[model samples]
Structures are given as structure tokens and as C-alpha cells.
Target: MGVIQLPSPPRILCFSFHILLILLQQTTAERELKFVVVVFRHGDRTPIVNFPTDLHKETEWPQGFGQLTKIGMQQLFELGQYTKERYSNFLNRTYSRQEFYLQSTDYDRTIMSALSYLSGLFPPSSSQIWNPGLLWQPIPVHILQKSSKQKLHFPLRDCPRFDELQNETQTSPEFQNRIQPYMDFLQTMAVNTGLELNHLKMLDNFQLWNTYDTLHCEDIHNYTLPVWATKDVINKMEKLAELSLLSLFGLYRREEKSRLQGGVLLNTILNSIKQAANSSKQGKMEVYSAHDTTIGALQIALNIFNGKLPPYAACQFFELYQESSGRYSIEMHYRNDSSKDPYVLTLPGCTSSCPLEKFAELVSPVITENWSKECGKQDKMKDIFLGFDVAVGLLCIFNLVLLYLLYHYGRCRRRNNYQDI
Candidate 1:
């Protein structure tokens, strides 16, 4: 005590400085996120198509089929506000032209939804240099077109492997088990409607697609659907559509296609992260505006199927930050509504702040073709065989029906001759 009492000013000064340095470092770390990636579903709209019995048809929608509605615009605007608040610390006080980028699948509704969302996210601030009368300034929104066969937007590309995956899904034991309940429900619907289960128009995938498209068109035109298709039916149909996307992406087989698509998207994300890890420039955020199908497909790929369609404005966000140890970690958040907080996701064996390299490795199997090679050519051939079997079965049934009719006619002719004799 006596030794310490000899006025240790140097020691006191050093200790105070050290404490201040620690506080400064903590503050910097808290505010030092460098990059963000967000993928989102497009906002609401009239049904893309209608059913056979729809009362209000495609012509009723002012913009024609598949256009966003006024309410959709409002929903996206609110979503933009939520995004702004959630990332306020990482984002600039006001959006900077240089700090953000956007991309959308090439479709009117998707592109327009992105535009609408940005309008609310970065509304004009005092520092904005727009012409006095302008409501907003232009931001660059990129689009990817001709990347695949189907032009219907994200989750609609015609991949042969994806088709094979869908076939595998139907035959998979797990899928049959999961869908047995729904099949029972469909049978109940058929009984109530006095429709034969086989004759039920909604049984086939294309028929379901047509029904949805027709409903979409009708909703746009302000036409009404049949009593049988109450709001609940429409909602259920939407869920089925979302499940179809998962089927295509192999979500049902977590060890297979989910790994591939998830790996592909994950690889793209990791590459973006590594590119940003060393950069000292103001960090950037990339937003992808797309459809529910796209969100569903990606979710299946990631083993995150939640058993419902992602709402029109649902979003998945990825943030990258650096730790004091000089390693980078990633955090993922999902926002499905304007009023709710985002939910966090941590990879297996990783904390909420996961190392970038580890994250890449965890999902590497998804993007590489090595796993597909293991499935072998037989899986592909099985798909072809199953398709032909269904086609030939239908032809045989048709021929049988035709022959039965002819036999009945000949029997009636012979009966009439005997009566004349």
C-alpha cells in the first residue's frame, strides 16, 4: 500500500487510456458491418390467371394480366420502411446512390415492385439533389433476362434436372407420406362437388397452373370466383404452387437437389462476400426482388420450407461483418412481414456470427455436380420411363373405352335383328 501510495500517475494514465481504447474498439465493431444481401418476393397483384368458372375475367384488370395493384405498391412501400429501420445503423442516414444496388427477375411486376420498394426506402431527404418538382430520383435496378428457357420470372426456368427432381419427388416415399393427407382432402372435395376423383379438373399440375393463372387474371379484372373456391381454397392453391417450386428444387430430398440449388445460391453469395472482405470502401447492399416461387425455391434449397407461401413482400437478408480477431462472419435474417422483427439463422456448428469460409464449405456440396453423379444415369432414365408409362397407360385406357362402346353398339344391332326375325 505504501509503495502504491507514492503517486503512480504513469500507471493511472496508462490504465485510463487502455479503457478508453477498449470502448472505442467496441463501438467501432458494433458499427462496422461491410456488406448486405437481400432477396425478396414481389408484392401482391391480381391473380395471374383464372379458373374455368371465374365470373370476373382477365379483361376486368385495368393493366391486363399479372400487373401489380395499388395495394401491392403500398405493401412494398411499407416493407421498404421496415428494411430501412432494420439496417439503419449499417445504412447511411439517407440512402446513398453509391451504397446500394438492386436486381430483379425480368418481369413487369417484379421490376416495378423493386422500383416501388426503393421509392419508400430512400424517399427524398433534405440533401437530395433532385429537381424541385420531382418526387424521387432514379436508381439503377438490374435485370437478368434470357438466362433460361421460361420467361415467367424467377423459379420458372425450365431445367431438365429440376424436372427430373420433380418426378423423383412424386415417387419418393417421404413425399407420398406428406401428401397423403392432402390427397384425402382432395377426395373429400371431389365427393362434396359430385365430381369423380379422376375427373377432377385440378388433379394435374398443368391444370393447377391454369387454374392459378385464370384466378390471377380474374382477380386483376375484379371478377369473382365460384363459391367452391372460397378465400381459403385460393390460399391453399397458393400454398400448393409454392410447394411445386420446392418440388422442382429438390427440397423434399434434403440430401440431394436442395444441396445443389442451395449450394449454387450460396456460392454466389460467398463470392460476393470474399470480394467485399478486403475492401475499405463504403459497404454496399444488394437487393433481389422476385416472386413467391423464387423465395420458395431458394428456401427449399436451404432446407427452410415453412409450409406456407412466403407473402408477397417477404425478404431474406444476409449481413457480413468483421471481428477484432481479423476474421469475417456472416449473419442471416428473414423478414416476412412489415410489423414483425427479423428472425436470425445460424448454420450448423457455427454461431450467429459464422466464419465466411466455413459457411462456404457447409453449402459447397449444393453447387458442385459431384452429388448428381452419385445418383447416376438410372435416376434420369427412371424419370423418362415413368413419363412414357403414364402416357401409354392413358392411351390404353382410351382405346379400351372406344372398343367397349363399339362392342355395345354391335350387341344392340344383333338384338334388333333377332327382334325383327
Candidate 2:
């Protein structure tokens, strides 16, 4: 989201090679994109966290911290244009809410990113142009309230088992062995940043990530770095950040942790894919605008993570295609580098053209029928109010408590089933 210029061609977009594969599948060799799902990280922005000795403050950035930047807008705009072209044959010439859907985490940057992407994906047709002066038209980008239990927000903090898994990940022998050489580095970073990161556990928790994010953002913006944060020092910090990201969803009991974190999102995506494959009337394409960690969690769940921090505007595509034989196949591709084609991602143990049923079977180990119970969490309420999206007739224990309960229950807590989406 900083000043890093996208490599020229001004359009660094990616389309899956399926454009050719589907052609080969059919006698006519025509486009066969049935349904598509896209999950992408928000474009770059100001750093969200700062070390105690940080040089920049919230006010220093134009829109304050964690908000989208001009570069980010351009990035998503180009990505949207790429999407429009990629699905040209499949998509209607004009915007149609029934054909496409967009959602984003309840954040300024993500909402903004979705809007920017929509601008390029559905630039105004003559009929959609409410204002001829403006080349854009507003489109709906659905969002759950911030308090809702949404899967798009990964490493969801409400799950006790996930927190336990993270603790175990830090103490695992494999993790200790990986960080053994960085003991001195942690101590040096602690001294330089005035942060308490003398132990690997501390780094795994957050201190190291904060340092790396701040420096990475600063470097992206071409800000002068502190003397202690030399090139070599930043490289070491980068490694620790990568490890920290991996710990968030993997490293120990990967499948169990995934069932609680990334698997939740995967479940939602799979359900949509299944419904579309079955000829459900749902939209043809779905896109989620979220964070880098969301991308990491999802890729880790799929067991195809490249083990690198997903860069700004990195988009992952999940396409459902019906082959010439009438069977449905799912294909995944990752577009992290704008300079090259999206890296093809095949579901493990399955071919690139993975059958929908086989893809579900391979990922079955991570998916859960009930994420709440699997997470070892109990949502307690009046037994009478059980199974109700909204609890009516609050207890009369106290007026204030009653009002709070009403407000809380008024917003239906989403179930892991993902049908609500």
C-alpha cells in the first residue's frame, strides 16, 4: 500500500491456465467457467502496530494507520480489470448482483478494497451509469457486524482450543530447533526496539511480528530506517515473522488447529462450491476481501502454503468448472507475484483438475460438522432460547443485564455451517 510501483503493463493480473484446459475438455474448446471464488488480501496500508521506539505515529499517515493507500487502490483496480477479462465469456456484459457477490471483513481498508475492485470488475455500462461524469457505480459489499463470529477473520480468538494449539506450537521441539540460532537475534531486537522479546515464546506471540510489520511498511514507503535495523537485521526479523505466521495456524496438530481456524473458511468455500456444482441459484462468483493472515490460514489449511507472507493485493482463486464429461472439477491458483502467472495449486493427493467430490474427501480431515463443539467451546444462554437466532424475553435478573443480553442476542451469532453466508 506504500509507494511501491507495480511493474509496468499497468495490469499485473492472472488467469488460470484452465482457459486452455477447459478448451481442451470440450469438443468446441469454448470457455467452461461455471463458478468462481476469489479470496484476496487487502492492498498495502500503514503499519497497524508500532514498537515502543517507533519513529512514526498514527497522525503521520494520511488516513491514519491501517487504512488503504493510493497504491492499494490502483492494485485492486488492476486486479478487478484482470478478473473482468478473465471471466469475460462467463460474466454478463453489465453488472448483475445475481451473477456476482462480494464480501469483506468489517474494516476500512477491506471495504475500500472491495469497492475499488468492483469499480474495475463492473465499470458502468451506459445503463448503470447514474452519473455520466463518474465512470463508477456503487455496488453492495456485504459484511457481518464486527462482533459476529465470521470465518473470514482467521485465527478467530474466541476459540479456546486454537489458543491452546498456538501455545503448544511455541513449545514444540520442531519450533525450538528452528529458532535456536535466533536466540541472540531476539535479544538484540529487544534492546533495539525497547520491546520484551528475549524469548522465542515472546516472538511467537507478537513482538517479532510488530517489529517486522513496522519495518516492512516503512521500507515499502521508503522511510529511513533506524541504524539498528540494518539489512541483515531485517532479514532475520523477516524469518521470525514468517515463523510466527506459520504458528498462528500450524506447526503442531495442524489438522486439529485447522478445523478451528482456516478450516472454518474452507468449509464455507466448499459449501458454496458444492451448491454451485449442484446447480444452486446462488451467484456465479464470490469474492472475499480480507487480510494477509486470512490468506496464510487458508493456504495452510489446503496444505499448499508457500511459507511466505502473502504480499499486498495477493489474490487466490478457487474456480469450479464442469468438464465436457458433465462432472465438476475445482481448480485453485495463487497470484502473489504480479510479474508472473498465478502459481497453480493442486489439492494434495489429487490431480490439477481435482474432482469436486475427491477434493472434499481429501480436505475432509480438516472440515468439521460443528466447529463450536469441536473448538471445545460452549455458548451458554437461557435453555428456552436454544436454537433461536434471536433470544426473546430476556431474563429479569437486572435491567442493565437484560438490555445487554437483548443487544447481544439481537445480532445472530453465525454457525460454522456457513449456510448463513
Off by over 4 Å in 2: 1-31, 198-200, 382-421
User: What is the Cα-based lDDT of residue 20 in candidate 1?
Assistant: 100
Q: lDDT, candidate 1, residue 164?
A: 65
Model 1 ranges with Cα > 4 A deviation: 1-31, 94-97, 148-158, 187-223, 231-242, 259-262, 281-283, 369-421
Q: For each candidate, what is the lDDT? A: 0.69, 0.84
| Residue 250, model 2: Cα distance from true site in angstroms | 0.9
In model 1, where is the ten-residue run with the lowest total lDDT? 149-158
Residue 241 accuracy (lDDT) in model 1? 59
What does candidate 2's lDDT look like per residue over 1-421, in tens digits? 6898765552433234556666567654543678999999998788888888888888888888888999899899989988888889888878998998998999999999999999989999777889888999989999856787765877687777777777787778877888878888777777888887654345556677877988989888888789888889998888888888887788778899888988889999999999998876878999999998899999999999988999999999999988778888999999998777798999889998899999999999998898888777875764435745333334344677978887777654544335556
lDDT per residue as tens, model 1, 188-288: 55554444555432332544544655565455445655666777777765655555555556545664665444455555666777788977664488888
Whole-structure CA lDDT of model 1: 0.69
Compared with the true structure, model 1 gives a TM-score of 0.72
